[model samples]
Target: MLLALLGVAAFSLTFPSTAWGLESFGPWSLVALRGVLAALIAGAFLLAGRVPVPDRRHWAGLAVVGGGVVVGFPLLTTLALRTSTTSHAAVVVGLLPLTTAAFAALRTGRRPSRAFWLAALAGAAVVLGYTVRESGGSLSTGDMYLFGALLVCAAGYTEGGRLAAVMPGWQVIGWALVLCLPLAATGAVTALAVEPVRLTAHGALGLGWVAAGSTFLGMYLWYRGMASIGIARASQLQLAQPLLTLVWSVLLLGEELSPAAPVAAAGVLMCIALTQRARS
Candidate 1:
């Protein structure tokens, strides 16, 4: 739980960091560059540990992880941030815990207790209500992108959690990131060529955090925690992530905090407590 909470803390900063990154980079460029940089960092660890290539059967799962977390989620969310406020995007993504739990059940064939599902649903409802109210009860193009990100990221998180059960958590994400290197490199090159670049301190710092801190370190801690607990249970912990992000947005991005934020946070935390106590 400690590990997972740390990972959530890292992720909570992603939107604000991406906002900083956009000060100098186009959405495509930011995604591609972060992928490449993260892959390189992962590769270094793999090399230092002299990790052998994973079994052939594992490659397919790793591919899904790469495609979802490394590519699809980052690309879509970054694009969405082009028009969406960090707070708005954060609330929309608050649905991730429920989505991830559903994916875990489908993929792992392990049903959590009824109480768990009920709590998860309640948490989702709170988040959904907060999101709808924040957006004036209407969806936007960015919401579409955020919803897409939720699906893909849930798939990635589920797969990564499963793989982590059989292998070291770091190796799971490390190999996945390495597998994405060629595509990331190609995209980075093309994006750098096409997108205008105006470097700033915030942009550099943002790129650094998203790549190393969020992508690599955060995933490492998250998968490890999932392996220690269980995927569905660990995923429930992410119910707190959106609240954390909202706090970060207010502190780091100078965004106004919604009055409903504290209420939503309290509700989500209660749901998380219920899910944690429920049997699997």
Candidate 2:
């Protein structure tokens, strides 16, 4: 439960750092650099801790989870924010719990209760309405990428939760970091090719957040939470993250709050309540 509780706070720090990373390179480059650094840190821990090697089955999962959650989600979401506003991205990401919940239901064939469905539906509606109000155009390339990233991340979260059920905190994420290195290297090359990124003090600080808080610490906590509380309950804690991001954006970036803040907050709160009730 504590793990679930901390998920939002961890993610809150990570997502905003996405903006910080872009100060140097494009989203992909930032992802590439961050991934390499995270992998190195995790690799050092693995060596120091004597972590076990992956079996074949572990490899299969490591591949998908690495591609889907670690790489795909951050990459897409960062790219989306390059064009879209922070609130716009926040509203969509606020629905991640609903996506994870739906995936859990599909995977387990466990029927969601009426309130679960109702809250999920209402949350989606609120997100859509918020998007329409903020971004008047039809879904852009960035939106599709963000949505796909969310779906891939949902799958990864579910699986990572299961991995946490057995593995040590460092091991599960260490393995993820280990498996993600190759692609991250490729992403780094790609990022440099496109953006020619350089490190100013702010860029370095931003990457520091990406390296430590966002990837290393945030991911570990998220997995620990999922491990302890189960994905169904833990994922619900994401409700706080978007709201927190909105608050941060307003305070830090001087972005104006939309009039619909109350409705969006209500939607997220209602969903969190319904998910909590179902879990209990």
Candidate 3:
């Protein structure tokens, strides 16, 4: 539980960091370069540990994990944040616990109780309602990107949790990043060739935070905790992430909090608690 909470705490800073990073960096450059940086760090970790190469079957799982997290989520969220506030993005991403639970069910072939479904549906309704109301009854492009990021992130989280059950948690993310090093290198180079990257001190620090903390360290703790606690129950911990993010947004980005934010947070959190109570 401490491990999971630590991981969630790390992740809760991602949106605000990305928003800060965007002040000087292009979304594409930030995403590509961040992956390249994380890959290097992961490579160093594996090399020092003298980890054996993964098998062919493990390669497939690593690819899925890398594609969703190392690429899809960061890229999409960066682009989404180009138009959306950290607060808005945080609220939308608050739905991740339910999505992660759904993917965990699919991966494990377990059916949650009907009460779980009801709680999940109610949580989804609350999130969707907040989204629609916030967006003036139509989904913005940013929201669409966030939704895509949500699905891909859910897939990554579920797959990584599965992998962690068989391997060290840090090694799981490290190898997953290593498997995509070639592609990440190519993307980073290509983005650089297309446009120049301008990084202020703050932007550089923000990029480092996401690459090191969000991309690698957070996954290590998260996968380890999930492996220990079971993904379904571990996912319940994510319900607190958005609230932390909202607090960070207010502190770091000086974003104003809406009264609706806390109310909606409470509603969704209640639903999450109900879902957690329903066993398989």
- Top candidate by TM-score: 1
How far in Å is the alpha carbon of 167 misplaced in model 2? 1.0
The numbered model that scores best in lDDT is 1
Candidate 1 has an lDDT of 0.94
> RMSDs, each prediction?
0.7, 2.0, 1.4
Q: Provide the TM-score for each candidate, comma-separated.
A: 0.99, 0.91, 0.95
Worst 10 residues of 2 by lDDT: 271-280
Candidates 1 and 3, the one with greater TM-score: 1
Q: Which pairs of residues clash in candidate 2, taking residues 3 or more apart in a chain or in different chains? A: none
Candidate number with the higher lDDT (1 or 3): 1
Predicted candidate 3 versus true structure: per-residue lDDT over 29-125, tens digit per residue: 7888889999999999999989998877888888889988899999999999999999889889878888998999999887778898788778777
lDDT of each: 0.94, 0.75, 0.88
**Judged by lDDT relative to the true structure, which candidate is superior, 1 or 2?**
1
Q: lDDT per residue, candidate 2, 127-237, as tens digits?
A: 777766766747777677778878988887777777777776556767887789998998798768878776676677777887777677777888888777667677777
How many steric clashes between backbone atoms does each model show? Answer: 0, 0, 0
Model 1 scores worst on lDDT over the 10 consecutive residues at 239-248
